[model samples]
Target: MVRERKFSDEDLFLATKELLLDYGYEGFTFGLLAERLGVSRSALYKYFGNKEELIMEFMMYELDQFMDKLRKINDYNRFEDQFDYLLELLMNHPQIHQLIEIGRHVPVNNQKLKEKNDKLDGLHLDMYQSLVGFVQQGKGEGKLKPHIPDTLIVGYILQSFLVPNFAQIPHSEWVQSIKEIIRNGMFTDDH
Candidate 1:
């Protein structure tokens, strides 16, 4: 007979994240998770009562990390620099992209999952607002052109990172050039 293996909270959390990335929210289940770990379903229940609870926990953990990074940015010279830094962070997180892709299919049963998702969404919205606020501050400080509205500034910043064509450019050079262009358009005074 084979001896049973015990799993800790950290083990469960890591397994849950990996399972979610592989199978997505709709496809993942306690039984599936247990099987993946070569454990019994009861063992999974001990850590997570249901799929919704597990998913919410995972999402909240990721959201917390994202917020932490946002709070730590202090040295950038301009809003675009901040935006580029954020873009680089996002690009490096392949797991986050996978989780986001999986999130779209997450099942909504009880209000808890929805509540957690709503909270994460609110954080993302707050980040966008911060980006807009940064641009507004830049204009007031004369670091950015006054003609560009906050909305356009934020939108364009996101577009540059999200759009595949420009996304290919290396993070460092892209950020530097974008910051320069945002402050001063192509064709300088000497041109």
Candidate 2:
């Protein structure tokens, strides 16, 4: 007889995110996920046809959570506060940018995968638009320099997450350095 599912979809997605981050796309496997979740491979197959579909679904769920958090940045009154909050949020999810990069290259072989990919693309666009809106708000408040393009600022912020941690600096110090570089630029005011 087929066994009932003990874990919810959210639990599976959370575990999948952890595994994907631990082992990149090339290394991730259904067997590993099933093992990690304490379920058989057949149990996982019931929800997703293949690894690609499962990963895509997880990406969609993650993006949804991310967008929800992004929208909440407006709750803060000051743009600087919002910027700090955004930075903290990004720092907390170190693997998200990598996952997004992987998602871009994931092949969509079937109609369902195609539809899911389109939805993921839409979520990505919404996330970008939310960032642009945040930038615009900062500009309106005269906190962000009007001379800089919104896309450039957004790109810089997003790419900052991918900065190499080769030095093994403390997380707080590293994040502070990033905030300083992004907000103040690399040049000293004394120059």
Candidate 3:
């Protein structure tokens, strides 16, 4: 039987965040984390049991932070402003962007990890829905074309935000271009 070990969840979270940032998702591992913490392999195992749990924990932490940031933008009365804020938040967290990219392509062996991914998917779907609601609102206010479906607009915005090769372009410039495109293409004439 494996003995459980106690470690600071905050420490583990920060360690995992730094590891994912430094090594990216593909290169991050428990052994590397243990080495960083100057702990033995067994000690690391006692704390996390496996890498998948660590990754999921980190993902959840990031998701919570993301939602919190979104919630704080309650003052933005316009959908375009909210969308721009969302883009800005994502652009600032490129490591998380990379982690998500890694998560999408990597295969997982555990059911819990799969479930966590499902939950993450649901969370993202909810965010997309919120954005679509804004788009629908814009349509009602004659701020967007009624002909364009909400799903397509949301999907396009997501694709623009989550591109795999974001490291190549300066994020500020990319964001500006994205905002410009979204304004010209999606926002209503009043924009």
Which runs of model 3 end up more than 4 angstroms from their true locations? 1-11, 18-26, 73-75, 95-98, 105-118, 161-174, 185-191
Which residue pairs in candidate 2 collide?
A: none
Model 1 ranges off by over 4 Å: 1-5, 74-77, 95-98, 111-118, 131-191
Candidate 3 or 1, higher TM-score = 3
Alpha-carbon TM-score of each model against the true structure: 0.60, 0.86, 0.66
**Which 10-residue window in model 1 sums to the lowest lDDT?**
158-167
Candidate 1 displacement at residue 23 in angstroms:
2.4
**CA lDDT scores, all candidates in order:** 0.68, 0.89, 0.70
Give one digit per residue, the lDDT tens place, for model 2 in 1-191.
98666888988998888887778787788888888888898899888889899999999989888888878898998888899899999998766778898788788899999999999999999888889989999999988999999999998898898888998999999999999999999999998
On residues 62-142, what C-alpha lDDT tens digit does candidate 3 reach at each position? 767776776655568776676667677766764554566655654667787788778877766665566677678678778
Q: Comparing 2 and 3 by TM-score, which wins?
A: 2
Cα-lDDT of candidate 1: 0.68
Candidate order by TM-score, decreasing, is 2, 3, 1
Off by over 4 Å in 2: 1-7
Q: Lowest lDDT 10-mer window, candidate 3?
A: 94-103
Instruction: Please name the candidate that would achieve the greatest TM-score relative to the true structure.
Output: 2
